[model samples]
Target: MLAPFLIMLREGLEAALIVGIIAGYLRQTGRGHWLPAVWIGIFLAVALSLFTGAAIQLLATGFPQKAQELFEALIGLLAVAVLVGMVFWMRRVARSIRTELHASVDAALAGRDGAAWALIFMVFLATAREGLESVFFLLAIFQQSPSAAAPLGALLGLLAAVAAGWAIYAGALRLDLRRFFRWTGVFILFVAAGLLAGSLRALHEAGLWNSLQQVVFDLGRVLPESSPFGTVLSGLLGYREAPTLGEVIVYIVFLAITVPLFLRPQPAARLGRVTDV
Candidate 1:
């Protein structure tokens, strides 16, 4: 539940921020007439995202047991990939995102021929990327834990993100976005590592992976995952009471590879202050 909540919060805020930037830019440049078209693009993108998620859910319900396991494994792997890529991409682009967005907006409006369509397409692509990423991550989370709490938490997170976006746009709230993203990036890496380990477990269940089946240790009697605190840990950090050798190895290796690179120093760039247009 907590995992889904945080993931959705981050993903929803990203989409909201992108839309806000475009809208702010349009307003600043006195191209406010294009705002309607931007909203249209956002609506279409959102509709597509919802439809895609529902269709996938319906399709998965018909799968047999092993096939379902395979599908879950695939979704988990895809989610991990998408999540990691998004984190790194955001980290790399954060410094110049506003400038790049402004440039894109200018280019969209520069042409008299189908300018509205161009802007609409640009906004659609941006929002849809975030939406699709959320869908896969949500699906993977749901597959791992089939409970009402996960969806409820996700809905709440999205609502909070909407509120945050509006507050930021309205200049009612100030945020330290640099620190926010940095800390959240680290949290997300841990989530992805857990997802990766869970994917391996899913693959084994699907008979696609059979090696490294040895149990590293059994914590079932001491700290069973079914316990309340254990459940929270399981949801947040992918804690398994009787984790296998492969799961532990993969989890550690993923963090070992990603955490340092993410934390390493890079060229100093300002991503702290959002453009107030």
Candidate 2:
């Protein structure tokens, strides 16, 4: 619960900040007329995200148990891809985000007829990227956890994210976002790795993959997944009491390769202009 909450909070806040920056810039530069386009883009992206999640949930609920497992595995795989890509993409663009936003806004407002549409597309794509990422991660989390706690955690995370974004914009929060993102990137890498392993296990259960079906280890008898601590770990890190050899291998390999790559700072990507309160 804590894991998903924090991850979503950070990711959501990042998206919110981008949108806020663009919106604020437009207002400051006497382009307040374009605000409607940005709002439209945001609403549309949100609607699309909600629709996509609902469609996926509806489809999965109709599947058999094995099929559901396979679906979950696929979702986890997708989530892992998005997670890794987001981390890398942010690392590369974090520094230039404000500049990019300004440039984009300028370009969009350069013309009259097509400006709104262009801006709409830009904002929609930006927000939707984050929305889709959130969808898959939350889906994977909810599949593993069938408790109210999961949704509650996500809601709290989202609220926190919004508040944080506002605080940062207002100079109320003096967080070093570069450092924060770096640490969260590391945490997300591990979480994604764990999800990868869980995905493999799901695939195995669905008989889609049989490459590494051997039992790597079993702790079901000693500390079952149903236990309080075990459940918490599983929810946080995709832990399994009786994980298969394939799952363990996949998890380890993902972490081994992704962690180091994620931790290295791209000095060129650090934001240069600091916002004054």
Candidate 3:
């Protein structure tokens, strides 16, 4: 629950910040007429996200046991890709996001009435990217844990995101967004690595990958996954009490590489019209 809550909170805050920035810029630039288009985009993106999730859930209900495992594995891999892409993409654009957004807005407004549709499309795509990332991450987490916790975590995450978004917009929250993204990006690398290991396990269970089916370590005697603390660690950080050598190696190597890359801050550029909070 804590894992999902934090992941969703971080992702949702990002989407909220994007929308807020676009709206704020529109208002400040005396182009508030396009605000409706932006809202329309947000609504459509949300609807699409909900529909996509429902579709996946419905499809999963009809799958056989092995098929379900395969589905879970596939979703975990996809989530890993999306999660990594999002983190790296943000790192590359942390400084230039405002300039890019302003350029997009300008381009959209300069077009004809069709420009409204373009504006909506841009906002929709931005928000949907975040939404889909959340969906996949939640699904992977849910596969490893219980269903009841996922919904609760999602709710908590949404509430936190709303409050944080409001604080950011009101200039009440003074986050070092650069550092925040960097650290969180590093944290997500671990999450993705865990998902990768879990995906491999799922594939093995489904008989899709039979090459590396050996248990490298068995700590069930000392600590079992069913234990309270073990369960907590498993759910939050994908800690396997008895892990395969492959899993441990993947997790460790992932952190070792990703942490250094994330910690190395790039030179900040002076982008135009970036509101400092």
Candidate 4:
């Protein structure tokens, strides 16, 4: 529950920030009349996300149990991929996203090939990537944890992001976006590690991978997933009372490989942070 909440909050806030920046820049440049095109882009992006997520869900419902397991595994993989990509991409672009976005906006508005359509497409493309990333991650979580709390947490996270974005746009909030994104990127790596383990388990269930089926250890007697606290851990961290050897290996390997990559700040970001100090 907490995992999904944070995931949506961070990702949604990123998207919101992008849109806010674009809109703010447009207004500052005295091109406020073009704002409607931005809104249209946002609407279309939302529609695309909804349509894509729904179609994927609908398609998965027709699969057999084995196929469903495979599907879950595939979705988990994709979610992890997108999550990792977003984290690093943001890291690389955080310092210059504003400049790049401003340039794009300028070009779009100055273009002769339908400026409105260009602006709309630009915003839609940007926002839609975040939306689809959220959708894939949400699907992975929803599949792993079936409780209503999953969706509820996601809704609250999105609402919080919207409020935060609005506050930032209104100049009421002065967030240190670098620290925020850096910490969340670390957290997301952990989340993706869990998902990777969960994906391995799903593949095993689907009979695609059969090696290392031995249980590493059983903690069911001391902390069963049915317990309230255990349920929370299970939902948030992919806690398993008796995980298989393959699952354990996958989880450990993911963290070992990804954590350092996440922690190692880009030289430019490090310099910017230092200069800010």
Tens digits of per-residue lDDT for model 3, 1-277: 7778878888988898899889989999998988999989999988988888889978998999999999999998998888888888877776678777888888888868698899999999989989888888887788878658767987899889989988997778877776677677777887788888888888878889777456788878777888877776777667887777767776778778776776675654633222342
Superposition TM-score, candidate 3 onto the true structure:
0.92
Q: What's the C-alpha lDDT at position 87 in model 2?
A: 85
Give candidate 3 misplaced runs (Cα > 4 Å). Answer: 267-277
Please provide, for model 1 over 26-72, each residue's C-alpha lDDT reduced to its tens digit, 9 standing for 90 to 100: 99989898999899889989999999999999999999999999999
| Cα lDDT for residue 168, candidate 3 | 90
Put down candidate 4 lDDT per residue, 1-277, tens digits, no spaces.
7988898999889998999989999999899999999999999999999999999999999999999999999999999899899898887777778878899999898977799999999999999999999999999999998899999999999999999989988888878888888888988988888888899999989999999999999999999999998998887778899999998998888889888987874675334531121
- In angstroms, give how far residue 44 of model 2 lies from its true place: 0.7
Compute the lDDT for candidate 1.
0.89
- State the TM-score for model 4: 0.96
Candidate that beats the other on lDDT, 2 or 4, i.e. the better one: 4
How many steric overlaps are in each model, in order? 0, 0, 0, 0
Question: lDDT for model 4, on a 0 to 1 scale?
Answer: 0.89
| True-structure Cα RMSD, model 4 | 1.9
Query: What's the lDDT of the predicted structure labeled candidate 3?
Result: 0.81
lDDT of each: 0.89, 0.84, 0.81, 0.89
